[model samples]
Target: MPGFSFETAERTHVGCVRKLNEDRVLSRPEVGLWAVADGMGGHQAGDLASSMIVDALSSIELLGTGYAFLDEVQESVQRVNRTLVSHARLSRPGTVIGSTLVALLIYDGHFACLWAGDSRVYLLRDGRLNQITRDHSMVQELIDSGALQRADAPYYGRSNVITRAVGVNDRLALDIASGPIQEGDVFLLCSDGLTGMMDDDEIEAVLKARTADDAADHLLKVTLDRGAKDNVSLVLVHVEPSVDDTLRTARRTLLA
Candidate 1:
């Protein structure tokens, strides 16, 4: 009720190549929780890791207040980490299982985002697109330090090398931020399979399409057409004023 939006649409894809999809998307319109997780590991472990993170987040109820929303997210992520580590060690002692989590919580026209790895969130508004989360990958760090130019980003370093991830590290250090939201704005949560295979320009073109489901399907199609080498997942949400505002106001007046 606090968040803007009386409507929503969402979609997810496993891509073309990988037999086991290691990506996950979760959405709760009522609570204004939307997220994406991309997992990394060997022997089908990646699939397990990413799903674990999503399930953890989905299980928790969205808090009634904005400040409590992030706390719920943090606690849920940590619980998933412990669970993943325990599961991985018991089943495959040497195998490492971890995942990147990007989540958005909207309340009272404000948004809070948290990132653990390369999975990302984008804000599209007024014909412009902006990437709101900074990646935790090796290549991103190099770019931040001015050691790598834009031309060299895709190939300069082990672009897959992530500095932080849920379940891989004992003590997780997540990047969290918050901001305001506006009507007619769109938010995208996607795995690297989409970002890795498509550039920002290409993504913007597809995301600007008519509807969220259409945009999501088009994006997935583009990834597959590009020879998707990994699993891909996407969640698109549009922010519009709630249509029920007038009805709710009348009810409030009657009660008063």
Candidate 2:
């Protein structure tokens, strides 16, 4: 399979109130791996947990078909989960040290999104935005079960309470979704810091109006402007036509 090339950008901020930024972002376009990890154990441990997650993923070297690559990505995440769990038990027993993970893997015109927390993966195609990953948070559960209305989620005070996260437990359950990539599709991977500050509509507008590079910066700026209470991080990817397709079009234009 011919590999699909992409335009990618990422950003992270400490926010106005936080003394330290616990959020970590990885943009390895060479391996087509991008991720955002938001740590949750305060200053000392939160940064450590998030950085560990990014380090583990960055060390992965996948050289196979798309599905095989996806498998390796999942395995890598699970391996890090176990490692973090053990480290926490030995170093800081009874203290929670975990991070929320959301990752995107693109290969051979195929893309896979894997996540474990409120951090999200969104696909913007044909001017419409679709969320590819669901939030494993307490408020999401309430909205799903009809206890809380979707419109009222922003007002909920406990929106930060996530039900699942990486390194939080011995057995980590990640949600994975895969699909074929389309030309002109834009994939947005972000931490809750962005979502907590802006609604879906506001996010969509920014994504629609800006290029991937500009979009990442603008999103972070907007979040900070709105009082980013927590660490903010995001990865933006713009999918383009394959090399073969672009060359073919050029050839036809030459003949014409």
Q: For each candidate, what TM-score against the reference?
A: 0.90, 0.95
Candidate 2: which pairs clash? none
lDDT of 1 by residue, 137-200 (tens): 8898889899999788988658888898988866888898888888888898888888899999
Candidate 2 residue spans exceeding 4 A from truth: 1-3
How does model 2 fare in lDDT?
0.89
In candidate 1, position 171 carries an lDDT of 81
How many backbone clashes are present in model 2? 0
Model 1 pairs in collision? none
RMSD (CA, Å), candidate 1 to true, equals 3.5
